[model samples]
Target: MTEMNYRTALVTGASSGLGRGLALWFGKKGVKVYAAARRRPQLEALAREARASGANIEPVELDVSEAETTLERIRELDDACGGLDLVVANAGVGGMTDGRNFPWEHAKKVIDVNVTGAVATLSAVLPRMVERNRGHLVGVSSLASCRGLPQNAAYSASKAFLNTFLESLRVDLHGTQVRVTCIKPGFVKTEMTANIQHMMPFLLEAEPAVEFMARAIVRGEDEYGFPWPMDRAVGLAKFVPNVLFDAVASKVVL
Candidate 1:
């Protein structure tokens, strides 16, 4: 295993949630961080907080949904840093639609950010990483990818896409120094999950979740899902026969 002591990193969707947490985590370790988000104020606020930790943070106002502009900004930021050691495609949205209603727009938006956006982020940085054979790509996918939920179909499917994509990317980059990691976290307390409007089993605060994620990245784990109890529960659910699963999972209060 190659040792990873990243000096610089780029984290997308850093305005809030896991993205912000991870950016700050890296900052604390003395890694220069380029944080990107759609909202300028939030990015500025994050940079301020990071600076307070004595971490260098460059705030880049970016919307991951805009693939072209997102790529352009990534290029500019990478150039400014001279290169990138890690890129976490963490920007995402949730569409809480149920089986009763098929909201095409919501599903499409989920796919745009969670799926297309992740690939675009990879596209923007992959060339340079390949050339150098040294970089880490992490997709902040959800443990929700393990099982599809009734009201969270779109969000579930989108994350599932990310999980699969990252896994395949890892295979493609097997012999290279460019490593790909998929982090499948369970319910986490963040602005993104604030609107979940239901119970999240084993919900964890961002700080601890960031700790787990940071460890995973440093260890170069191909797949990381936490907290462990939730990961096991979700992974076990995969083996439940559809009939029993439908009866049990469908009755889930959330």
Candidate 2:
């Protein structure tokens, strides 16, 4: 296994879910971790947890939905750290919407957080990485991005956009020392997935999921999706006839 021993790292959405797990994982490896999230209390709690384990983690209050401030804050953090060896744009939101009712507000929020927020976080750090000629950027997408589902179209679309955005970054940065990785996870047992009503095939807890993701990041994989079962299912779904897919997907409650 490749040893991911970055000196300094920043993880957005580090207050909870996979983000929290990733921050803790990095911290345990002796990486100075800046844990950014909208919730200050949660961030503090996470910091305490890390410190208890002899991990160097600091809490950073950040709300990625605020584009201008998010960009400024991330850039400031990057500079303050001398330089960030790794940045994970892991902040995102999920929503369930019905096409018939068309909840524009909910859909808009999902896009704002998942797509725009991620772009802001990445764009802020990218320039410095390019200038330094070394850094790793990772974006957390979803397996749902492989296909649009009935009630969760907005969330799926946002992840799809992120996947494409990350792909573009990887391709454009070719031959550069900077690396870009996109991690697409299936249903993980996080707050986001807690309310999912339908059966979640190959469900994994947050810690294991984050571990899998960390390995991929350290290996500098351009794009990765997990677990293997979900990845295969989604891959096959991509080739299914639209009519048949629609017929089956429409029945999904999530």
Candidate 3:
């Protein structure tokens, strides 16, 4: 878990939002970054900006939900890079619906991308890391994982799965050079939340959020929950009675 220079980092969902933020931030630190997203144009623009800043950035078109395609791309990147030092399984989606009324298809898609996709990415990269015995894996969870939210039931549950999965991996990797960290962040101003009609408490801009996440990865922290206020809020939400939480959360509008 000692500080090591990461030569190459792979970031999924890099077309925009937190993934884009992380790619740009890591590039600034002189790491070679493989930015992946479904849109080639946006990914190319990101690559252009990062390259202008002197970071080795390669944009790859990817849809993490598409297991086969994503796995193939990872293999190609691993072969191209010689090795991958970091993998950020950051692709995710959010849908608003009460648990009972939520569309089954949408719920399934959330689990597919947030849960299965995350596992698939790790599976594709971990063997190589295990062989080399050196690498960092970061899964982007959310403060919503701290407690169940009424409207975003599937989204919250998906993140909760990630939180637990990463924590277990952290323990499993004990004594090995490989590191795992789960990041839980409050609302951030990104494409993901931009359309939401809810008030976001202690929301942070994407840049600072990315910087914090990257620092946590560099420090090899086991878990990171951002914006002190949001951390405290989530902490309290965990202990608060469900009745009170439901009532309070029902009124929120971003």
Q: Give the winner by TM-score.
A: 2
TM-score of each: 0.95, 0.97, 0.93
Error of 1 at 119 (Å): 1.2
Worst 10 residues of 2 by lDDT: 1-10
Clashing pairs in 1: none
Worst 10 residues of 1 by lDDT: 1-10
2 or 3, greater by lDDT: 2
Q: In candidate 1, what are the lDDT values of residues 110-171, reduced to their tens digit?
A: 88898888888877978899998889999999888988887889899889989888888899
Which runs of model 3 end up more than 4 angstroms from their true locations? 1-4, 243-254
Best by lDDT: 2
- Residue-level lDDT of model 3, residues 120-176, one tens digit each, is 787687888988999999999999898878777789899999998888888888998
Candidate 2, residue 33: lDDT: 95
- Model 1 alpha-carbon miss at residue 32, Å: 1.0
lDDT of 3 at 66: 88
- Report backbone clashes per prediction: 0, 0, 5
For each candidate, the alpha-carbon lDDT, in order, equals 0.87, 0.91, 0.86
Query: Looking at candidate 3, what is the lDDT of residue 111?
Result: 91
Model 3 residue 241 CA deviation (Å) reads 3.5
